[model samples]
Target: MTTSIVIRDEQSADAAQIAAVTLAAFATLEISGHTEHYIVDALRAAGVLTVSLVAEIDGRIVGHIAFSPVRMSDGSAGWYGLGPVSVAPDLQRQGIGTALISEGLARLRAIGASGCCLVGHPAYYGRFGFSNPPELALAGVPPEVFFALSFTGQTPRGEVVFHDAFKATGPTPA
Candidate 1:
């Protein structure tokens, strides 16, 4: 049976839950450094979490997604990077992640964002209209995993740099 999920912008009260969910989601992923929660916290603290959202079911936050401004080497603006999307391990493949991504993308477009990009599994992101563009790249990331979705009909051509918060490996600074 599928439970109904409510997608909404995250509030301050949801910080700890978001962190817990994030940690649980990436806990066993071999490719993860297990620092997703820290990255989320750093983004929030740095004021660069352009779009932060959560998926709730029966008043419990089971999933979270974050988007932040990305710098394009070709001087392109209005583009954002998507990442660290997390869904509870037990809740994986239940559409919670999809809901968070869909709502987050809509929110970004509504705010005039030109596009969004991410380093993710090719098969997973392709269903959401994300594609790997030859001209747009994320250094050190396999081209197959770097995907972009252009909302404004113009895909940026250059290197994509996600926010520095993605490098956070410890507690948020005071």
Candidate 2:
């Protein structure tokens, strides 16, 4: 039997579960700095978490994804950054993360976003239409690991600066 998964906008009550899922997802990822949960919290606290969604199965939160505005050095507008998507470790490879990414990308397009970029596994994100564009770069990040998908079909040319929250290294202060 196939499991049913529901993807929906995150509610305030889902905060703790989102953090737990985020932490668990990246806990064993060698490339992960393990500060994803902190980044999520900072984005929310800074009111820059433009799109935050949680995946639910059996009424329990099992995955989370976040999208926030990104600034292009060229001054192009309506671009966003996708990140920190997480699925419970026990549920990995069960399509939970795929469902979350698909739904999240649809939501970004619905919002009139010009494009979305992310630093992710090259093999995984390509299936979602994310590609490494030589015209755009995120400083300090190699081109191969950085990917972008242009909803408007016009790729911005310049450095992409994700929100400062991406630098979050600790929990948010009350």
Candidate 3:
């Protein structure tokens, strides 16, 4: 069975639902090593959650993704960080997550992001033009898996440091 989903930017009031979706998305995944619900809450609290997109169907949110600010060492340079992309377990592979990611990336570029980076599955993020940052790989990162895409001059060279909240989990809720 298949279902249709619509993607849209998240509203302020959707915080509760957004957090809930993230919580549910990571409830069963130990890949993150622990629950990620706390990360989502922290992101919301930090006020850096500039971009959020959701995939909804029949009034229910089935997928969610967020974009926050990331900076290079010394915090002098910046790039958008993509993560916590979640899809309802049952709705995985229906393109809901993809839509949310696409919308968020578009929004970031529109808002003047120089580039975007994320710690995610190379196979997945690679499909969207996110490739390892070889120019200035983050310390301890394989570089091949730490992908980046520049919207301006060069893939903003520097280590990819996502929000502190992002490291608290495996991109489940944060």
Query: How big is the positional error of residue 38 in model 2, measured in Å on the Cα after superposition?
Result: 0.3
Residue pairs with backbone atoms closer than 3 Å in model 3 (clashes): none
Per-residue lDDT of candidate 1, residues 5-34 (tens digit): 999889999999999999999999999999
Please say which candidate is ahead in lDDT: 2 or 3: 2
- Any idea what lDDT model 2 has? 0.94
lDDT of each residue in 81-123, candidate 2, tens digit only: 9998999998889998898899999998898999899999888
Candidate 1, after superposition: displacement of residue 77 in Å? Answer: 0.9
Worst 10 residues of 2 by lDDT: 1-10
State in Å the error of residue 110, model 1: 0.4
Tell me the whole-model lDDT of each prediction, alpha carbons only.
0.94, 0.94, 0.75
lDDT of 3 at 28: 86
Order candidates by lDDT, high to low.
1, 2, 3
Candidate 1 structure, TM-score to reference: 0.98
- Cα deviation in Å at residue 87, candidate 1? 0.3
Clash count list over all predictions: 0, 0, 0
Using Cα atoms with residue i matched to residue i, what is each candidate's TM-score against the true structure? Answer: 0.98, 0.98, 0.84
